[model samples]
Target: MLIWLFLAMNFIITEVVKGIKHLYNEEVAESLISIQDTRKEFEGQATIVVFPIVRFSKKSPEQTANDLGAYLVDNLKEVTAFNVVKGFLNLSIANDYWLDLFNNSLLQPDFGVIPSNGRKVMVEYSSPNTNKPLHLGHVRNNLLGYSVSELLKADGAEVYKVNLVNDRGIHICKSMLAWQKWGNGETPESSGLKGDHLVGKYYVIFDKEYKKEIEALKAEGQTEDEAKKNAPLIKAAQAMLLAWEAGDEAVIDLWKTMNGWVYEGFAISYKNLGVDFDKFYYESNTYLLGKDTVEEGLAKGVFFKKEDGSVWIDLTADGLDQKLVLRADGTSVYITQDLGTAQMKYDDFKMNESIYVVGNEQDYHFKVLFLILDKLGKSWAKGLYHLSYGMVDLPSGKMKSREGTVVDADDLIAEMVATAKQKTEALGKVDHFSEEERETLYYNIGMGALKYFLLKVEPKKRLLFDPAESIDFQGNTGPFIQYTHARIKSLLLKADYTPGVFIDNQVALSETELDMIILLAKYPSEISAAAKTFSPASLANYIYEVAKMFNKFYHEIPPIVKEEDEQLKRLRLSLSDVTAGILKSGMRILGIEVPERM
Candidate 1:
């Protein structure tokens, strides 16, 4: 699906550049591409040339170039007049050329996509465990992963969205153990709690009880470590694990109940957030998948067996410490599963790039994982990327699940929607919308605000999630952009405007309008860069810039008013349509919905 998108984008870019050359009679000197930026070099070919429209330098150079281009329009150095200022040389084509861009940008279905040369990208994220409900941290992960995949798709790459579920392990056992001890046949239906949160509550309860057990063991004259090892909960968990491995009916039955609850909860959250997966993997089924690979490595002399019958890889030669591949009992660990998954995905998709959208704390893990994969002679290991986004911190400091400081995803989203509803009512906006429409609008605005807040910063930077402040609608936010989109919709409705109409060709481009065009033009480059870097924040920031510009343009240039300059009003309204389209497209890149009425 994504492989063709990149090729299409490349084709469109080629055509657009070709159009630019024909319109301006200039030849591009060179084009530069980066993981995060792009530049195009051009040389004026006409004897009498147009002026440079943009200058990257100060007023001195800008003024000089402005004067030079104007004086040479039909005078000296007329054909090759424009000069590069710093790196941004703006070539001023005829007024008709600007009109041409407006028409083309509006008409081209794939206006901003670069042509793809058959690259495949696989993005993995939202690897939630069944032990608890997702929290704000997972929200960040999902948004980042989903948005990056979207951006890659937009950039014309074949993108596969994948996820790994930590369905097995002791952490999951905690929830299962707690449910077995205290559930007392209480189901989500009877408890009136969301399944994941209900299980999470018990998980929390199990810890408190486990702590008391530890205290009791310590009072019996045991060391703290010894007490922990002997705690009843720990012992019970170990016993239950043995039963589970033996396929005991009681343990397996409880596991099914608790895991089912968590799965239902996950489905609800993913549906609400508009996140979907092209593939799903479970650790329970695949955790030991890499055992054969490890054995192969041993046969190939890439790994060695310790005296304890465990397999280990010595990575000090690769600037990493030695690491365990398989335990003495021959159980595969986290990295082992990942190595197998990588190989499986490569064999399945032949992907050129694979992105793991995990937290920054796992930096060391991925570093070792990739190195081992490469050492195992998988050439595609070099393409493995750790899209390590920073943790979501609270104003109070880091969120600790054991301390009960973590915010639940379902609860937070509900709160945001309720807040949006309240704001809508206070503004008397709901009176203008149907009941169902109002509810939908709330969902759109609330989720938009939340997703945008998470995606507005660079991925590597830690995000301070302030529930109160993050929901603010008045400033640089998703709702702010949604409001702009709604405002445009409102005007179009009031004026009865159609989509593809150009009421007046006289654009009369103001600073705001020109700025909007330039910003809009950056959309393709921004999408490609963000896709390359696996950062949705880049697209988020770009949309916010568009909204800011449109706000300025709206207040300074009214589209519908009595006795307004009809020609100017028409141009402004057309520009508003363009701005709205760009906003809609950009917001889509972030997996956000821009409500028509907010």
Candidate 2:
């Protein structure tokens, strides 16, 4: 619509330049046109800057603005009036235009969703290892990835959500070896522990024992590195990795059993997190995938072999150090697996874009991976993106998985829900609800608060998760927004809102009312900007502002149910209805559920 107005203004200005001014230079006329949103102090809807055209008119900025403003007012029905401020020609849109925009938006079921643009995008997130239960870090990863995928979908791109499980490697072997050596047939069912937690316990146990052995070896006069390498437990875990790689049935069976437990645990956590993936890729299946790709790269001379038979890619030319693609023993390294996975993903979806939602620690890793693929002449490599996000910390400081100090995702979620229940009960807001309804509401608010708190921050910045701060009902928090939605819903219900009632054009709108209409009109553009930047923070903050504006309007404007005039009541009710719709729509994109009753 803004573009349409710009085109309309351009045509009118071009005509004015050719006929009224007798200056037919197309370049001068084109350069003179600039349309933008009116400044807050300006009494208009849109502003046309006339400073650029003053030279063409050989007139003062104010006079040139006045001339252009007169032409626009006479030509465009939407431009009912205009004012000149210095060089800015501020045009006031007629009240009917705002009403029509509201009505058009109300008629459309999916107001902010863009039409399909025929592009496929693959977003890989929640790349959790099978060694342990997901922690707060994984929570951030999943939320960011899921929200990004939804943003892309809202932008009309075909998106595929994927997860890559690190089910192989020495990390998995640590847990398996620990269980084999220490366990007397303990399982999740027997221990009454979550599967991932149960497996994680063994991993921690392995670390503790490995440290003890290393200390003992050091006490026996060996150097630190020698002690670490000679530690019996570490060596056993290393052997287990080799055995599993060699397809040893016993090692493979143990690996599957333990990984199965972790998978089951992960499934529950993902469900609780309200995140899902269309597919899952396993390192066990993909570890050898890149070996063939390496051979191909070597054949193409994209990678060179050293005397020790190790294949390397000299990315120094690309401003990165030379990276090892394959070891001297002909074993595939991390980059090898990544190369194979990239090709496999491309082969699977042929996505126009493939986004890896990884921690910033792996920024260099992705740079090398993408460069290697690009050097291999893969066309889709250019579309690969590393959505590197900063780590999530707690007020308690950093977490260490080996030390068993990380805040587990399941536990954090449970705590959040509990916190919600406590906060809601303290406020005495759920006195009339049943236990089931209360539980559902608590879940929605808890998860909503959790997700919104994480997503409101820019992805590249490290965040401190403060549970109490996030669940507040009176600030820039999720519950505050959720409460506003509930408030609007309650107001609408009390008024018995009836759809399709036309607001009278003669009706006067208060400043707050007009401001809200303008804000509501910006929703589609906000979503587009959010999608384009791959940042939910934009939409999150926009919705917060909308909620804030609505709250102010609720306090300042006349009560909708008590408005004396029928037209006024209908208009106020329409405003409330549209505000609620946009609030719900925006929160949905952030993977939040706005409850009908808080």
Candidate 3:
């Protein structure tokens, strides 16, 4: 895809080198002749940095630009005209060049994609705990992971999407104990609530009641810290955790039932969010996996046992404190399972890379994990990456799970769809549509708006998501891009667009039309940069520019269906088709759907 675009730059660079040699009697290297897209204010398609060639010319910057511009205009047919801005020499390509490119290159379906390189990658995300339903934070994590996987695939990699479920531990035990102490046995069927929501209700109830217990103890002349440790509810939850690990049939059965409920709820939310996993690893199953690994590390002297029989790795010399891999009572720490899981994933796929899409809070945790794996002489340690992102904040403020103020993923999605419906109907375009079409269109736009709003920013930056602001049709929002795509589709349908049509004769080009073509030419670059940086923000904003430019062209140029010149009309219609194709392609990488109709 980039080959065609680079050919133009290559031609300009080759000619600039020749121009320097001819004028200065100096043979300049092609690398020394730098070229880029000309500034919008300049009346050209490409620019050359004449400052670098100044040493050869032995002239002022302006004089250098003027000298090279004159040579290119006279010698190269592709170079129709030239303009000089200080040391920058901007060269205009002939109309025939853009016309040929639009006809032959831009209209291809996969114009911006990288061909498969057969490299394998795994992205793990949405590792939600089974104690509660997923919230807005999980929403961001899932979207970032899914789109990153898509971008990697677009960059010619074979990507695997996976999830790790934290279905066991003290947190899960809290919800179980809360439910057990409550009056009656309530199920999803009985409560008419989603399974995860039901479990989450108990989790919150546990916190509410646990707080009361702590307050009561503190009121009894106890320090606040001491009261927290002596809280009866917390002690019971701890006991439940031990009983769970002991494989007591009654406790184990209850744990399985609650976790099962949460999983079912997660599946529903994931489906609504348009995200999925290729495989799922549960902590309950993987928690003990690292003991063997710990044993191996001990044998290799990479790990040492403390006086109380705890397995630890001293990393103080490596600039980190000693990290525990196993407890004194033969229990695994969080890092222990992570080490085993890393090795297990490598063994399973032998993939070239692994990316864990976690939040920024775990930054140090991953740093330690990767260092330990590397210290263990693992071959794939260097390929591990932690795709850390900032937390999402609502207009209200930060979310808290125990207080039950977090934005539920399922609820937020439904609210977005509702907002989309209200905003979309005000346009009054759905009157002629059926119920099902309206619903589908609403889902696409709502989900598109949500995903775009979250993914448009770099993952490292925390963002305040406003659903109302994201569904606008006149700004850099998802609906705006979707509406542009639908408009282009409408224009093409009206013009009765013909495929494989080329403009043979030279025709007048509007400034807006020229700008549209130039922006269209940048589609491949947008994809490549986004893939290289693993940033959908770059691609998302690039698509916005394409849509914005096409809108300008649409309003500024004469209507295509009404134009009398057959060749000109064909060119305009072809431009519209390619613009829509590129918009759809870019949006797909961001996991957004562009509708054919508004």
Give lDDT per model, in order.
0.76, 0.86, 0.87
Clashing pairs in 2: none
- TM-score of each candidate structure, all chains considered together: 0.86, 0.94, 0.95
Q: In model 2, where do residues sit more than 4 Å from their true spots?
A: 1-34, 50-60
Candidate 1 local Cα displacement, residue 592, angstroms: 1.0
Residues 1-598 of candidate 2 have per-residue lDDT tens digits of 2332322235445644553354324345454565677777879867777766767777888987787677767777778998998888788888877777666764356667679999899999999999989999999999999999999998899999999999999999999999998978899999999999999999999999999999999999999999999999988889988898799999988888999999999999999999999999988889888998989999999999999999999988878898899999988888889999999998999999999999999998998899899999999999999998999887877887765668889998998898899889998979999999999999988998899999999998999877668666568888889999999999999999986667767887787888888788778778888888899998999999999999999999767898789988988888888889888988998999999987
On TM-score, the candidate that comes out on top is: 3
**TM-score head-to-head 1 vs 3, winner:** 3
Model 3 weakest 10-residue run by lDDT:
1-10
**488, model 2: CA deviation in Å?**
1.2
Per residue, candidate 1 scores C-alpha lDDT tens digits across 292-395 of 88988999899999999999999898788989999999878877887787778789889999999999999999999998888889889988999999899999
Each candidate: how many clashes? 23, 0, 0
Better of 1 and 2 by lDDT: 2
